[model samples]
Target: MKSTHVLILLGLLAACKSQPKEKETEAPANAPKAEPIACYQYATAADTITLKLVNMGGTVGGALIYKLKEKDMNAGTIKGTLRGDILLADYTFKSEGTQSTRQVAFKKTGNAFIEGYGETTNVNGVEQFKNADSIVYSSSMKLEEIPCK
Candidate 1:
């Protein structure tokens, strides 16, 4: 009886060990990867740059071009370089008599269109008093094509 009990226990242990655990599966081979609907890298021709900071408004409508690192029109975070023309679109203003330049880091999201948001001091400069500012910018940039080149 003792020997039989030992054999049964061993058999149960072996059976439990032999059973396979579930394995992780990869997505289907035909699964589609997300691609941008449209994207553009600013070249020599600078687009119309506009800003509405507090009661101040400025538009640097000139040859202000930008570079594209990895901006996906469909992605939530659209980031890259924001330099070309001037050192920066700087300013100084105040509601109660304090002034500072704007500074901001832009991120875009949406469909064929993208909306950007960041500190005024991020894009502008230190004189904008960005700590007291919360802003979102709507891109007038027309979605053309995301060049793979």
Candidate 2:
């Protein structure tokens, strides 16, 4: 009788040891995730400049439309990385009916993107912004953010 009681007690102890304990804190499985942000910016009526970009984790992908007075329009797709409110990208566009690629940069201020001052280079017979600085806000060049519809 004593041996049977001891065995039953040991079995209960083993079973208790094998059982999992309830966690004091647990996260829900259906938590919502963060979504990427997208924005559209355009210049005022004085200039024909438009930019649309989707920013995910400081990486920017966008399109740029530059329509200057008496000049051929530049419609381009931009792919670049953003660092601390600065976007550096390569723009591939069609200007004067020619397809070309160039480097461009923009500085974020408030809800506007100011064109960064930079030097231009001829790449494959196309002009491009090489290295840039965020020191200049050219006339009718600042892109103000508008609601993307």
Give the candidate number with the greatest TM-score. 2
Q: What RMSD does each model have against the real structure?
A: 15.1, 10.5
Give Cα-based local distance difference scores for all models: 0.35, 0.73
> What is the Cα-based lDDT of residue 78 in candidate 2?
88
Q: Write the per-residue lDDT of candidate 1 for residues 67-101, one digit (tens) a residue.
A: 33443111112222233311133333332344443
- Model 2 stretches with alpha carbons more than 4 Å out: 1-36, 56-58, 123-130, 133-140
Q: Pick the lDDT winner.
A: 2
Query: Whole-model lDDT for model 2 versus the true structure?
Result: 0.73
TM-score of each: 0.23, 0.62
Look at candidate 1 and tell me the lDDT of residue 87: 19
